[model samples]
Target: MENKIKILLLEDDDNDALLIENILTTSDLNVEIIRAKNKESYLELLDKLDFNIVISDYTVPHFEGIKALVELKKRNKNIPFIFCSGTINEEKAIQCLQLGAMDYVLKDKIEKLIPAVKRAIKLVTETLEKEKLEKELIQFKRAVENVHEVIFYTNPDGIILYANKAFEDIYGWKIEEVINKTTPRILKSGLYDKNFYSEFWNNIKSKDHFVIEMINRTKKGDLIEIKNMISSIYDANNKLIGFISIQSNISERKKKERELQRAKEAAEEMNKIKSYFLSNINHELRTPLISILGFSEELMNEITEPELKEYAKYIHEAGQRLNQTLNNILSLVELEKKRIEIKYESINLTELLKDLINQYSKEAEKKGLKFITKFESHKISIHSDYEITKKVLSIILDNSIKFTNEGGILLSVRTEKINSFTHPVINIVDTGIGIQSEKIEHIFEPFRQVSEGLTRTYEGLGIGLTIAKQLLDLIGVEIKIQSQLNKGTMITLIFPTVAKEEEIKSEVEKRKITIVEEPYEKKSTNPEILLVEDNPGNRMLFKKYLSEYFIVDEAIDGLEAIAKAELKSYDLILMDIHLGSGIDGVEAFKRIKSFPKYKNTPVIAITAYGMTDDREKFIDAGFTDYLKKPIMRTELIETIYKYTYKNN
Candidate 1:
């Protein structure tokens, strides 16, 4: 604006151009006048220069002012143009003005020329500013109309003043039906009380904005959930003019949330029912099965006649098979529900494998298969959940024995650098019926058997490997299987190496079970034991089992056990959990252990309640140890001896 206004002057007569420049100079307007002498010069100068205004003679030598004005407009649409003629031809002046000239003036009346030029320049500046403002307004309007959420503006009186296309599309209302035709009452579903409306407006006026999930009615009479946001709109003077509302249709999302909540409740109810069922199954069926299995095992061991012994063996074997199948089913359920808690501690993998070999070798012997170990010298100590680790390895070894009929199943161990860490690796290679290559990947999936339908010969639930794999994952132990159909399968286990022997873990291992293979020598003086059991058969069977080592006493219920303990504290107490419903074994243990003589005495929890959490639950209840029933004589004797030796 500080620069001079440059004018392109087109006039053949130098006198007229000089006069115009003098007039501008006299008016004290800052001006730079560039003259084009003729029509050719005028057109050429127009192409070469830029100017704020153009002043041209109506009667040039070869170009009329009309033609010059039209040509100037072709190049610059908004530049101001004025006509100056030597003769006072009124008709020609009018014609020049009609041909896009801002103003036309005669030389005799030249006073009007200067004022016309100034007014024309001022008008052009105002028009350009107005056009720029209008373009911005159009863009803002387009953006508001195209948004997905419903947006509307209202006057301070709450009457709807404006609404976007989204309002009609989302709320099921036409534009004409809503705008200035109704209040907010049209969208209200009457679900909210009058207090809700009062708070809605009060909060909006008090705070910067208000947001809520509101229930509203659509034009089609369908109720919907809306996430409504409202804020105040203000004028330039800071007066509240209207309110702006943004509503998101969240009906579908709300519906899904309700459905998910109901599903969660239903699942929880089913779990409660399942837990009850499993609890009953563990107590009712297992309680009698324990005594049956024990007596059958005793008969098989003591019977002299071959035929009678064979019959006893058959009963014992069938019970063992049923027990194992039940265990597998329960384990599968716990694993699927993700309810098994892993308690990691130091575990002797060497002893673990030895136990598995001892347990399964007889089964392997029945089929004339060699079950052997190659790493007895290598005492592999590892950090893992001892119970789960044992279960995982036992499952795999049991499957190996179950599948293999003739050849050997070998257990071997070695050291290797796996992932740059030296880990002790145990490999169980079995020369049994191997898996098909394509089926190996799916063996870890539950109930996915390699042999399907009636033609398959193997007797199993097909969840052994699935449970094995899941337990391994829980303990962070890695297992891999390699097999060829009908050749052999080799399973590799990489263990978490045990920390140094002196480095104790954060929590001491309560079940520090040392598998001692050597037989225990009997002491001359026997320690007495109190066997509290309600079932007559279980009482008889347990007394018979414990009589060889301990001077055993009996109680048929929890009250009797407590009464007996008040008289004399036994060296050890085998407390049965469910004792004919007369204040169960756990409560009796608490009372018996309160006596001075029995304060630190070993009170073993003997129960058929062997659910996934049962052992841990009982152990945490201050039992010296826990034994799931149908307990064999050897294990029961061994558990008693271990506690007595520790007490002694």
Candidate 2:
């Protein structure tokens, strides 16, 4: 582009070389010409020096213009090579052009030399600029390939225009496969909904950049989470070109976050269970102790001869109630720990209900409530862990009796056929102060009462519903409740029932109450025994009355008695089923029967767990007799003689 262009003149003919040189020299255009006589010298000059254009003759001594042009190409592929022929032929000129010569000039018509050289120089300058740009393009491609993230360019219509090796690697696809495919159709993992992508585009159109977490798919169809950043690219005229996206895989990070959330939820559930246990345990232990202390003081004072006996009876009843609470609490803990073992058996629902109502009718009468029992038919039976179900039902019905003040408690069992199987539905409805709306949801929650007001007025620990809920849940029975504040609460328990041959045999056996021969012709020299246990205070009260007739051992826990089995031998073991391990007494008897030495031993399971299932579980776990805790002194003595020393 500068003045005085340096042109290399490679012509073997002296006349042509001189004429071309003079043509350029004489014109107003200034140019310096360097002459090479032959192809050898022209190529040598080209190697050592740069030239603006080359003017060469078509015919040389050893090499023609075509050979020299070929040699010029070897030296600089893009340099202008013009052939000046003495007798230029159309065929040769066409051949020159085909060989990539810039132009063919006739030496006789030297006028065209200057103009052709000027045009050649202009074309050569443009060619040089294009080569420079190509070099830069190769460098940029390498930079993109070297990056760790996937970097790609997609056209406005979403066809992938270009992508680096990393992009191909990240998607597990070859470059050719992804080059022209639309982004969404090829790589979407369905994690992004319509709104997600809609907002993505909206932001990009407004702000020219987008960043988001996306789940993308690979060529192999594997899903991966990625963090992507996209920016709009443009041309020099500010027209839309395409977009460049930079993405990094974040699949592992997303997985870790999900795992952490699950662990947090599990910890919260365990904490709730622990909190309930602590509250219920304290209440169960304290209630019976207060009753025993209050009644024992009255009896000790001997205020009235008739009242003294009544005070003693109250102490015994309180002790028995305390013991039942302890057992329930312990059993629940064992169930939570996954330590309770279940024995599945077939049971008759009708007989079980009758026995439960018979035992609880007196207590309901004492509370000024009528006990109503309606067993529709005896045919319905359930396959379950008899002991557990009995305990669960007992807790439910006991709650009804304890809460209802004046109205009658109704227990009804009906059978419904659904899906060709009989479903036994048991309902225990009470006219007690119904659970408040908000508190009803949590009534089955341990130690939770309807109100602080209700807790103060209620004499028992708030574990009956909790125990019922847990036991029913274990046996796949669903317990539902309906209640209105101050109106009433009705609990419905649903259990699957099927007719079985074994249950018929058990029913027939229960119907025949036969007398067995006595072990001794006369009562043993030792007197019959009854054991009463309530809270610690009630335990002392029962001990004073019962110790007069038989040897008595003490236990604060059902667990302690089970442990003490090896140290002492007794004709019978009396267990308070509701000892505040609340269900613990049931578990203790279960454990004792599990051992071969104690499996056949006579055990009298007594408690507030006097529900139908409570007695069934006690018997199923190898108890010879069952009694409700809070023993009546005269009744306790009479029942003892019936079981322990039957001979008259």
Candidate 3:
């Protein structure tokens, strides 16, 4: 292997051995020769020395070159052996060559010795390099076969040259059957059109690295989705020799993706249907409920008989309950759909709880239960959505009053420093029929209620807490509840940020400033009102109510309302949305507002479209104010008086 060759020679004649060394030294092979004359020294030296070439005399006194060549063959060394004999028969020379001697040079014509030695060195070097390369190739094959991904290589002609073990296992084919015997078309499933195949071939040839998702079939004809990557393998001369492909099975993943897509489409369809149903149901139910509640309140006021008045009161109360339930359902939908907007404001937590406590106190007293409160500080406030905060507390306190028949409800507030920030925490402790420990965790789940004793007296839609929790989470507030069986429940409302005292005072002063009493002057004894309603019964109700305070003019639809408004200037207008097959209230209002005289006149939105978004939509459409239907007498009159009086 080294450039400096070492040769061992078995020669009795030192003169001849010196001659061979001188001839090799003249060449550039860098020769080193050591002489062994006899049989024992010669054979022992052949076994011990790691020389490149062995040269020997054919017939020494005790040594024969034929015997040494036979020994070299037995040792299985690939070293080259040569003979320079004084007397060698034709049969003996042939036998020596057959026994694996590389070449022989006759002593008479000794010029052939250097050429024979040169030939021997070149052959051995080529053989060694070939053997080393074969070992490395085998190791590379083993590594590729052990990976999970399918790996294969093909020649430039698109003929499969080699494939790893994973390729055979995944494709259900033996490696011998595919290698050098098949092309990529053998696995094509024909699921794609001709254009797909054309694209596939073009991309691989044009790009150095190409990846595509393909549906290919196994040997057994089972389709499989795979993501395949092909990269060109180039040789040292910068010529493309072959392509290497790696494939990952994605059949199961693709199946799941298809299923999810279908489910999404189905859900979208259901949402559209639900919106249609909600729209219809809102108008259908609230339209009649408006008449029921309105007429019942009217009857309760005018009826003289005690029994008749009590019946009217029952009708109004039941209508109110239905209206509240409907509101909760729509509110829960808004919260679930993430359509509710959260606007944070500084609110006086003390005054908020006091207002809620005052509102619910009468209900609790009517149930023969005491309502109590303890404010740790009268000045604690929080930066949160005021309406959402009020609604969450209202739900908890209302639930408390409903569940507790005879037990008192205690509402308290205290301030604490959590994580270096002041948080105002409101705790509502009620001695009601408490919930089980296992049920406390699921109290915020929609439409989920736990009745350990299966109490049938409590009534609710069961989504109040769910809505409360979602609204609080949107505003970054936290709530916690602790309860025991029949012992009562303690709920903690943790506000995220505590507002400064200056903010509370500023809000209080703003409210106080708006309460200034001003001298009132009536525009006329009877202010005119244009009542626009499509429903005949609703039209009569509105006209009857407003007729007492204004010279009421009636219009059955938006067209009529616009026509009447053009003919007469009124103090205020009650416009109902969804007026039959004609235009809606918003379009009619826009038309009237186009006139300079009616642009500033108050046109209130009174509609049965009671979804959470509908109220604000009307307000944003430039209505003076919005009032949901199923309207009560007090609410309708008060809203009307606010716009009509405009004084104090």
Candidate 4:
């Protein structure tokens, strides 16, 4: 388009030259013509600038047609040469064409010469442009091949025209296989809709480009998600050629997204369960705690005898034990939910066992059982969370003492060498009511005490093993058990030990801290406790038991509890579920916790409904602890000790 094309006309005859000039003049073309009357003149014209089309006579007096074409082709092979002669031979015409002449024109049919020349000129221009485009296309293809994304070209009929190395790598198919295969048949995942592809093609044709996400199958039959951008290609005449597509493998990202969604759903479901259990636990605990506290308080204040006061103390101790069990249950839930942080340390196994033995001596003596230690190592240390390990050991020993009557409990420890590392094993053998054959497998599960009916009579929350199991899991320890129905139970624990111990020198004796009790303070020693209840007997008994610990506050319904908690500074609250009045304890706990001042204060639950999941729900609703009625004095004391002593 930039340079004007020049034309060379060779005709020794003046009349033929005039006719050719007339045809060129009448044609719609922009070209400069040069006439060469002799061989010398033609050679001189060749030395000049370039020509787009050459018109020469076949039989000139001095120069021959084929020779002239050969010379011109030798110089510039791209320039189109046409023969305009009255006596043109078929062989010569064929030779000229083979030598790169565009076409031949007859002088006798001068009218056809202009049309022939015009077509030849147009073709020359088109061929030259096509050659330029082909060069650019080669460069573009090379660049696309080097790109990281899998690039491919395909026709409307779905036959692949070209594919890069990346495409072959992604599909596990060779370039030859992909180039000959149809798009859908080769890589269909059967995850796309017919309408989806229809719309995809429509957009690509109409808008020139389209982006989509689809699942595709590899040659190996592995399914992968791909993000693709496809664009339609066109030639100079604006004719549709094919499509060029670039894609990336997104299977890993899709997997992560799906896993995240599942985790979120699981968390939501657990939260709902937690809420339900919390409400039930709170109602169960508060009812008994109130009874134990109130009855014991009244007896101590009214009896006025030292011997009678001892009975009240015993009641208090029983309530405290029940409360301790609730706290431990809550702690297990927190551990399972990863709400608690454990501090890791290097601990001496020898010292740890000795400490546990000493702590459980008094309890074992009360149960009329002796504790025996089998020390496999006089000095052994390992890397672990010392406090948690101690708790685990203490629980096993306590359970052993609780169930055993006359037989002694044995604790043993040893180490095993395992391929460049040492593993520690601890065994606890108790001569107690051993686990039943069917119950052994599920003993570690929360709220499940053996069907021996011992739990109902014995003082325990049946959650100690649950906590121990969770704690051991956190530290990568495995616990195994072998038991006979009524003879004895042997529990084994295995854990990896660290040789290079980072010795912890702290000698802090683990003891429960008690807050300084202010006797003469004007503040009520018995803080007002809200008792939201429905049953008249239960409410009366709850008030009677709790009178010793706090000022008994009454709320016949959940609405009353919420209203009272909003207006008063009750130190603690005891909420009952299934109130005869409007709203339930669950709704009441939510409303009470919603208030800023009551958020951190402990709220004990008293309910008849108790389940493994109830503890988490109660805690989630802002209840500090939960107990099933009728409450023991030890349980109440333990729950009070947790909140009161913990705050202190």
Cα lDDT of model 1 by residue, 109-217, tens digit: 8888878777866766676678789998899889989999999888876789889999998878998888885556889888989998887777677654556678999
TM-score of each: 0.58, 0.39, 0.55, 0.39
lDDT of each: 0.78, 0.72, 0.79, 0.75
In the range 431-524, model 3's lDDT, one tens digit per residue, is 8888989889999987687652367556776888998887776665678899987889999987764434454334334433443355323455
CA deviation > 4 Å runs, candidate 4: 1-268, 272-307, 452-459, 500-648
Please give the range of 10 consecutive residues that has the lowest summed lDDT in model 1: 504-513
Clashing pairs in 3: none
Error of 4 at 484 (Å): 1.3
Candidate No. with top TM-score = 1
- In terms of lDDT, which candidate is stronger, 1 or 2? 1
Backbone clash numbers for all candidates listed: 0, 31, 0, 45
Which model scores highest in lDDT? 3
- Write candidate 4's Cα lDDT for 1-648 as tens digits: 556557899899999898888878767766678899978888788877667788999989878878888889889887888899998779878888888888898888878877777787787779899999999999988998788789988886667988998997889999987786777678888787888778766677775655566899998999999878788888899888888888989888668767866786798699668845854685589678888877887887788788988989888777777767766856765664556555668788898887678878777777788778887778777667888898888888888888787787888899876433467889999899888888888998777786536445456667899889878765656688899977989999877545332210010011001112333233564456677787788878776666644577687765567656655667777777545223447666877788899977778887754445667767776678887655544355456545654432
**Against the correct fold, how does model 2 do in TM-score?**
0.39
Candidate 4 lDDT score at position 45: 87
